[model samples]
Target: MSFITINNIWQEYGDHVVLERLNLQIKEGEFCSMVGASGCGKSTFLRLLLGQEKPSRGTITLDGKRLVAEPDSHRGVVFQRYSVFPHLSVLDNVAIGLELPQSPLLGRLFGAKKRAAREQAAEMLKKVGLGHALDKYPAQLSGGMQQRLAIAQAFIMQPRVLLLDEPFGALDPGIRKEMHAL
Candidate 1:
């Protein structure tokens, strides 16, 4: 059996049907891509898998367990726009997820734990080629750099599944290729 399964899925908003009777299976450690014209069900399918939206019919299961309706640390996501925090520095933004599990109310990671999170965030950003922009605010970076930061932020959490929603929509070809390499 596959690790992720979508069985006879259906999604709709009032009278508009986005997805209908879709069946898919994804195995562990496998890479899958979805391609279609704009306004197709690609984003909807990703959202369903992420539990951002529930199926109007049928079921989605991960590892044989039905997916719940809420966002959680088990899933990571990067949207095309507004993925980064404008107020936080790049390093701080990347470390936010690392801090969350330590304290739900305050996220008061300090001393070595804080430093370790910062180091890991730096490594992740460097992997995505954003090391030099660690101290810069999101608004100070270019569109492509911002997207890289978003990817790093998502990756730092080490989520079981990563969902990207048109993340490369605004990048030029060269930047897009670089992002693909990361």
Candidate 2:
């Protein structure tokens, strides 16, 4: 069975239609990419996959079960724009993902849990070449660096499915290539 199945999906916003007659099946460990002109529903489709929106018609199933229209740890996304918190340091931005899931009420981890989360965030940042900028804020970094920070933030969650929306658009060729590898 497919890992993800989109059956005759359609997306409509009142009088306007964003997507139509879209069907897809993805096997486990498979990679897929969608390309189209602007305003053509690529992001909309991604949002559906992320469970941020429900399609107007048809159904989407993940791992043979109906997909829920709510965000969960199973999926991680990096938007075209940097989604990192400008007020937080790079390390904290990434670490917050780890902290929130475990402490939804207080929205924080205390003592050793907090330290472990930060350490894990630091390790992920190092993998994305942002280790040196751990103390910097999003505003202090360049566009490409900020994009990498967003990627690190998403990756720190270790989600089952990762969705990237023009994530490398701000990166130079070298950095873009490195991100593809990472």
Candidate 3:
């Protein structure tokens, strides 16, 4: 079986059909790209894969498991809009997934395992070429840096699948190409 499968999928918004009978199979560790005109359901497809939305018809499965809800840990998503926490430093933003409270009281008093999470976040930031911006807030970075930070954040979890929705669309052509190369 395919690692990721979208079988006979259909999606609608009221009377408008966004996707109709779409079928795709993606193998594990494959790099795939989908290009089409604007408003052609690309974002919808990503959302479906992320389990942020459900198709009106048909099935989506990952490694033989049916997707019926917002998937946990197994998927990561990056969007054109910056999803980083504005108040957090780059390190904190990238480590948010790994810092879920062990206990509400412990998190409140001890700050959620900062050392290890920060180390992992730093490593991911370096991988994405944002190592120098670790101390900076999202507001302090340029658009390209912010996007790279977002990429680092999504990838730090080492999710089984990554979904990107126009992740480089906001950048200039030059920077967009650079980000694509990373």
Candidate 4:
């Protein structure tokens, strides 16, 4: 069976239609890419696949189950625009995703757990070439740096399915190559 299935999917906003009769099947451990002109609903389709929005018609299934109507940890997403928290320091931004799911009540991890989470976040940031900017706020970083931080944040969760929208558009060629290696 397909790992992800999109059948007769359509997304329409009011009188306008963004996607029409979109169908796809992806096997387990497959990588798929969507290419189209701007405003052709690629991002919108990603959002739908992430369960951030339900299609105006049709259904999406992951592992033979209907996708939930809301976002969940089973999927991670890096939007085309940077989605890091502007108020958070770079390290905290990445660590928060790890902390929240493990400790939902406090929205944090304490003691050694906290330390481990931070360490993991730091390692991911380092892989993305942001090791020196751990204490810096998102607003203080360049657009490419912020986007890299966002990537680190999304990946640290180790979600079963990852959705990226123009995830490397802001990076330099060298940095993009480094990111692709991950």
Q: List model 3 lDDT by residue over 1-182, tens digit each.
A: 68998899999999999999999999998878889998999989988998889899999999988985876789988986868889999988887767764434544224456777778889889877788888889999988788888888888788899889878866778767766776
Instruction: Please report the candidate that would top lDDT against the real structure.
Output: 4
Model 4: per-residue Cα lDDT over 1-182, one tens digit each:
89999999999999999999999999988889999999999999998998878899999999999999888888999999868888889999999998998998999999999999999999999999999999999999999999999999889988889899999999999999998888
Which candidate number maximizes TM-score? 2
RMSD of each: 1.4, 1.0, 2.5, 1.1
lDDT string for model 1 (13-112, tens) is 9999999999999998677788899898998898898898889999999889999899788888997564677899999999987998887888758889
TM-score of each: 0.94, 0.97, 0.88, 0.96
Over the stretch 1-182, how does candidate 2's per-residue lDDT look in tens digits? 99999999999999999999999999987889999999899999999999999999999998998988898888899988768798999999999999998999999999999999999999999998999999999999999999999999888888878898999999999989999988
- Sort by lDDT, best first: 4, 2, 1, 3
* Candidate 4 residue-wise lDDT at 115: 100
- Please say which candidate is ahead in TM-score: 1 or 2: 2
Off by over 4 Å in 4: none
Tell me the lDDT of model 3 at 114.
Answer: 70
Question: Any residue pairs clashing in model 3, and if so which?
Answer: none
RMSD to the native, candidate 2? 1.0
Query: Quick one: RMSD of model 4?
Result: 1.1
Better of 3 and 4 by TM-score: 4
Over 4 Å off, model 1: 172-175
- Candidate 2, residue 107: how far the Cα is off, in Å: 1.5
